[model samples]
Structure formats: structure tokens, C-alpha cells
Target: MTASWPPAPLSVDEPVGAPTLLPARAYVRAEVLAWERRHLFAGTWSCVGRVDELPAQHGVTVGDVPVLLTRDGDRTAAFANTCRHRGHELLPDGGSADGRVVVCPYHAWVYTLDGALRAAPRFRDVPGFSAADHGLVPLPVEVWHGWVFVNATGDAAPFTVHLGELAGLVAPYAPEKLKLAARHDYRVRANWKVIVENYQECYHCPRIHPELCAVSPPNSGHNYDLPGAWVGGAMDLREGAETMSLDGRSRGAFLPGVDRRRVLYLALFPDLLLSLHPDYVMTHRLRPLAPDTTRVECSWYVAEGVLDASYAERFWDRTNRQDWAACESVQRGLASPHFRPGPFAPNEDAVQRWVTLIRRAYLGTPPWEGQ
Candidate 1:
């Protein structure tokens, strides 16, 4: 390692005024992945899952900790999933304790919907034992649009502040009111960042995703400024295409208030990849497992009355597999001892911005506190 960002920069590998890629080691090193898990994911507003996916279940795993998300009527709450006594899991692993109140399955300790300790078995006469101190360990949670996001440490910036102008940008679509049509899961054989970089750019679409290029011209898009913490933009649909299908045909009604012919793609920093089409919305949440492996959960959501998402799901699943194959190939190539990052293309502006952001975050922040 050196004084320079990413230890070494291969400026000679590409042209001047071009963005440099992150070092290969950053994607392959274990300690680097650990640092990202702690700083970039843990305290951040990690999207556990959507409200519609797990209808009655409230438990989720963020990083290594299990956090619970519960709703009572119009109210919602989040907290550590362990009971105050005996540290037993208040909710079974990845299962729900949903009802009027959360009951610890172990000792029958009970907690209110708001995570307040209500009953503690039969231990009554313990002097100075305060229920106030034993209330569930609360975690900050926000149900943005339709997605549920949680901040484990409860010290990160407020969810709205972190989102910035993102709310107003997508309000016209009323994504909160959208309904899930289909869901799919995959174990991607590539790093999380590789998948993200692939999603943000279409430079390889012409070669790798002919099905995608058939619907929308890969070059017919403009990148959006930082509306919030997210980075994304839109691509114009071809003359006759109504949505992003294999042949650019609509399988559902156009979304409410959507009159234009374009598709919106956004990487809601850290984890969520959001794509908004004329008639539906698709999202991919990246879960980094090891340095070279990631798990991607994809769901297609359509507005009310749009029916099922068979068209959209089949289309994107094929496209997603194509991108994943390429990413896995890139990862294999990057593993070589002499690999170096190449320059960013003019069309890869979103990829460039993402790389710069990651580089700054990695280099600007001290590796550890008080170092």
C-alpha cells in the first residue's frame, strides 16, 4: 500500500481525463470486504425487504445481526430480535412473531408492538429492576415508498436526509401503492460491486444483452444528477416500444401518471437497484456473501389492475443472467496477478461516478477510528 488511493493507480493503462477503476485487490481481499460491511452497510439504511414480500414476517438479517420489523395498524416499529432476558430470539430465525404483540417463544416474555417490555414471565420482586431499561433495543427504521429500510446503530443520518430529493423525483409513480407481481432469487458468481457496475451502465448491452438492446437503444439515455444519495438516469424507449420487454410490448397497463416513453434506473447506494418502466417496476437488492460471491433478490412490481408480471419477469431474468455471466467472467479475469483497471468510456459516466464515490469513501475515511 502507498499514499495514493487504492494503494496503486494505473494511469498508464488508459487515456487522460478518463476515470480509473478500483484496484482488483479491493474486490478480492477479505479485510476490505469486512471494512465495507461495517462502514458502508451496517449503520446505513439497508433495505431488508419490501412490505409485500414477507406479508406477516418481520424478522430480517442485516450484516450479522437479526433485526425485527413489525407493524400494528398504521404504525410500524423495529428492534433487535433478541429478548431482554436470556437473549433468546424473540422471533424465530427468519420467522415472524406477528400478532397484537411480539411474544418471546423461549420464556414467554412479551413485548408491545412498539417494542416496550410488557411481561417478564413471573419475576416480580427483583428490587431496582426497571422495565424501562429493558425495553427492546430499538433500531431506526423507515418505510420509504414501499421498501422497509433499517439503520442498525441508530446513529447514521436520518433516512430522509440520506435520501435527499429522491422522494420528490419518484412520487409521481406512487411506488408505495404498487403491488408485487413476481419474485426471483439467484446466487450471482461475482462480487457485489461488479453486479452494481454492470447494472449502472449499458456499454456492454449491445454485445452481451441483445434482448435488452432490441427494445431500447443502449445509447439513448441521459444520466441524472445526484437527486439524492442515489445515482441513476433514464433511457428513451424506441418508437413503438411501450415497456421493457423482449420485443418492447406492454403486458400491463401503463403506470399512473406515466405518459412519457422512458425507463428509469437507479442504484440506491449501498444495496438497492431500482428500475422503473412504463407499466411496472423492477428491483434487485445485492447481498454480498464472500469476496467473490453475491446474492441478488429480484422482484417485479406492477401498479393496481396491471395483472401478473410474467412479461417483465421473464425479460429481465434473461437480461440479468446475461449480465451476471459477464460479471463472473470479469471477476475471473481480475483474479490474474497482472490485472489493472482500464479507463472509463464516455458512455460509462454512471459507472465512473460510482467508482469515484467508492474510491473517495475508501480513501477519505480513516480505516479505523482514532488512527
Candidate 2:
């Protein structure tokens, strides 16, 4: 099994070069909020909700925004789930139906599945109103396999195109076959950038995630890149660790179109991550709770019908708890008067790479376009 399931080579290893080191102060600055509004919340591809979570009448609340993601044949669509009139939320928190029309609770402003305004109450009397002009606003949504992503501002580059160099990084472990398993949410008394940087590298994993080190190789000990920008790098499973496929099949068993061979950890820009291992997959979304606080929600995934429940949850939950404790501690330390910026290890280049990219993008100087 080990011989057949060969691991692929890592991505390019050239240093990101000088004048590109990640700035430590960007994640929590009030000034950075404008950038997020311009680049991330409005520009980059962002996850909306899981595919499995979109069966019937389900919805996920992002800030004051309520988004409805639903399936139509093999495709999915997202709509701003708000009534065109009184601003009432359209669907109940979690419910589903096999129909195409959405009726608002307050005034029955019905909309087509494609988000066009279908009918409204008292239309004839509303002199200046036109249903065609008042349809539900559509968010820029793209579905890769079963994961759903949205670009809120309706102006981001095409989703796949924006993923750029990351496309091949996660090619080994198929993202489509993964399913949600377990979830844990954390409200941290820290800024959003701190959580992202903390997750960018495993340099502190040996000191922080001792148990996770037993399963996934620790990056600091190995020669893995720590991409400083919003980049995700993979770490191979320990040489002979116990492994299972998402379908409950042991390593090497194929699940139709999936490889099911190894593990992958995916970090999407701004605030989402997907950690795929041989045994299970984990998903995380970071919501800014405040200028000084952020909420981290995590969900684990397995193949469609497999149920290890407590066992799977325990393993990933332990890793998450460890991460939370470490990140919180780091947040507290950042308040200290003497902390300073530093250099990166030659081998631990992944986190540094991500930092550099993010800093450049936020400053409106993307990597591709020269300053």
C-alpha cells in the first residue's frame, strides 16, 4: 500500500526575496479593515458554506449578511437571502426544500432560484417600483467539487483563476470527495491576522502541537515551506502512520474518482482552511468578532456515509484545542512592549511566503504586478 500510494514532490522552493517579509501589524490594524473591504471581503474568493450543508432550506450567517446556497442539478447558486422590501431574512436558519421559488416571511416577496424578483405584494400601487429592477442581489459564487465559495463584492477575478499557483498544491488529495464530520468554534480575544499567521506555519507545532506532530510531520523539523502569503502547504503523514480513506477504506483503496492515498492541509486566503488527511478532513472559517476579537469555526469531514463520530472528532478536536491554546497565548504576548519582527528559516518557507504575498496584496501591490 505504501509503495503504490507515492507522495508527490513539493512546490517551488525559491525564497520570496527581500523587501517582501510579512508585516506583523497588518492583521489587527483599523487601517487594514479598509483593505479587507477592498481586497478580501470584496475581492478574493471566499468560502460561503459547505456543499453538504446546502440540501434544502439551509443558510449560513456571515456577519449581518445571510447567504443562501442551494443546489440546482449539478450546480449551486448563492443569493443574498433578504426581502427586497422590509429587509427580512428569507429562509429559516436551517431547512430545505426541493422547490425553485423562495418566499419571504414578512411580505411574501417571491424570487426565482436564479435570484430574479418574481412577484411582490401591492406592486400596482407602488408607483416607482419595478420587480425586474429589485431582484435579490447575487454574490459571485463558485463551487469546486462540493465546496462553495463566494466573492461578496461581485468584482473578484474568476475563482479558479484567482487560486493561481494553489491549484496544483491540492491536486494530490481530491477536494470534491471530502464531507463535513465535526465542528468547533472559538471566539478569540485577538485580531484576525494573528490567527492566519499562527496557522501559516508549524514552526511552533513541535512546541505547541505535540500530538499532531505524532500524526502529521511537523514543518519546523522537516524541510517544508511556510508560505507567508495566503498560501497553504502540505505535510506528508508520518512514514508509517495508520491511515484510512474518507470512504472508510484503508489506504490505497480508491473511491471512484478520488485518490484516497494521502493527506493535505489547504489554507485559502483571508480566513478559511481545509485539512485533509487519510482518515478525515477538517474545515475552518474565521469570522472577525470585533476589531480586537475573531471567531474561528472548524468542521471535520469524512466520505459520504462513514461514521466514526466520537473517535474522529476526538483526534481532530484535540489538535484544534491545542492550536487554540497556542494562538491565544501568542495574542496575549503580542500585547507586550518588546516583541519585534524576525527572519525566516530557510526550510520553513511556507509561512513566510504567505506573509509576503498577503502584505503585498493588502498594500495593493499583488505579486504578479511589479511595484
Candidate number with greatest TM-score: 1
Task: Write the residue-wise lDDT of candidate 2 on 1-371 in tens digits.
Answer: 00121111212223455433333345445655554544555455666666766764446554345676667666677777777888888875455666788888799888877788899988967789888898888877887656678765565566655666566655555657765656777887777766776676777888877666776666523323433224655565565554422222233222344334345555677677766565556677887765457878887666666655456566657767777777777666655566545567655465665665655564454332221
**How many residue-pair clashes does candidate 1 contain?**
0
lDDT of 2 at 195: 71
Off by over 4 Å in 1: 1-17, 54-57, 105-107, 364-371
Using lDDT as the measure, which candidate wins?
1
lDDT for model 2 comes to 0.61
lDDT of 2 at 302: 62
lDDT per prediction? 0.78, 0.61
